[model samples]
Target: MVNSSEQAHTEIGPLYPTYEALRTAAQPVHPSSSARRLLWMLNGPLHSAITVLSSEITTHGVNMPSEPLYDPATDIWHPIAQEPVSTPKVSSVTVGVCQLEEWGFTWCDMHEGHADPPELEDEE
Candidate 1:
């Protein structure tokens, strides 16, 4: 008895949960942890600032960066560039998305164990 729109959303509901989860979770991890954990998992190296921040999160516990160096102009940290910066750890998922976007990475349902992001076929 579901409408087409409901059916469509239900069909797509399981995909792309990162944004939803991060958005709705009671306590989303700080951007520093999210960035460092993801980066370490992908590249095997922690952001220089995150090295200290991670230890503090492990020991003392914190949500914001221990030593933030953000730049209000760009709405991001200092040394803005394509590659992830070592200093000025990110503090929010929004900023983390910006960093990932810079690396050509986008939110994907596949990341949450669902199908990969859809790709369009080239017209022949």
Candidate 2:
């Protein structure tokens, strides 16, 4: 005979596997061949500067500019403040629950209640 807890877990379905699949799908794509070729063609100084900029962007996410502003004095184009880049908040349990819901799994809080799954911890 299956225990109540076991039955409950079964009803919740396979959450971890679904969460893993979703997380894998969410990974960033590599730069295309054309973009790589263009990077290769860039001059040494320009290439170095671009490489540094790319590294910084990768390390600390950049805020997308809403508008471009050109200053005649400095002869530089600057980005106006807009929406900031959002940090990633990965919760496997939450994602799994959402995925289950997407697959037509109905949750009853009154019976099962809210309990944090083992994989509820946020991933870096």
Candidate 3:
């Protein structure tokens, strides 16, 4: 059966035209040896953090009120009911890596150091 999140995704349409488009847009960084090692060290933590945050957001809702409640004692309004945030599941380490890359976190690459040098501007 299709989950509510899947139904929401269907309703909202895709965030990208295609998966290829998403990869292109990610502009994945080519890491140096040091950066590569850093990324290797970070991968597990990053993946765990993403998973935890995604779970929290899905479980606790996005703080959006489905219904409002008013308190006469202090004249305060609060959410009577909250609507859970519909988010696509981060199913794997690869998915987490892709998200980090897309957000310019630069920890996706796992190749030998071969980053392009920065271009220098010509002095007038």
Candidate 4:
């Protein structure tokens, strides 16, 4: 078996320092290729967005009526003054994409339990 030290790679310093000076913001220290920059920008933005969305969903779940609680139905925010639903089966149900429309609730109204014009019309 090869020792871990034998697999090490060497770090190479920039070969063309003089040419890199033209692009530096603070006196142009080094020039980076456009591809490297594009890669960084693309991956950085996507990673940041995913992180933010994840945080929002988690916070919303906790803020639900039941502390550390989440519900598959009535996506609206409510503060239930009783023991939150803790059954494993109920918690594990995967809600299909926005059944609010079928339930006569518009996307926005459904999540917030707001009645839309159509839903209101049906009630009359």
Instruction: State which candidate has the highest lDDT.
Output: 1
Tens digits of per-residue lDDT, candidate 4, 14-122, equal 2323322333434423212211111112243433221111221322332233221223355532233132222211212233556653565554555674333344456
**Model 1: per-residue Cα lDDT over 36-93, one tens digit each:** 4321223433333332232224434435344333434556653323333222232222
Off by over 4 Å in 4: 1-10, 18-20, 23-44, 48-124
Clashing residue pairs in candidate 2 are none
Going through the candidates in order, what is the number of backbone clashes in each?
A: 0, 0, 0, 1
Tell me how candidate 4 scores on lDDT.
0.29
Off by over 4 Å in 3: 17-124
Per-residue lDDT over 1-124 for candidate 2, one digit per residue giving the tens place of the 0 to 100 score: 9999889889975423333454578854333322222212135443222211222222222342222233455765433112122223222323245666655334555435555545667879
Candidate 1 Cα outliers beyond 4 Å, as residue runs: 13-25, 29-124
Question: What lDDT score goes with residue 115 in model 3?
Answer: 66
Stretches off by above 4 angstroms in model 2 are 15-57, 65-124
Writing each residue's lDDT as its tens digit, candidate 3 over 1-124 gives 9999999889976543333343467743332222111111234443222211111122334333222133456765433112222122111122345665565444435332546656889999
Residue-pair clash count for candidate 3: 0
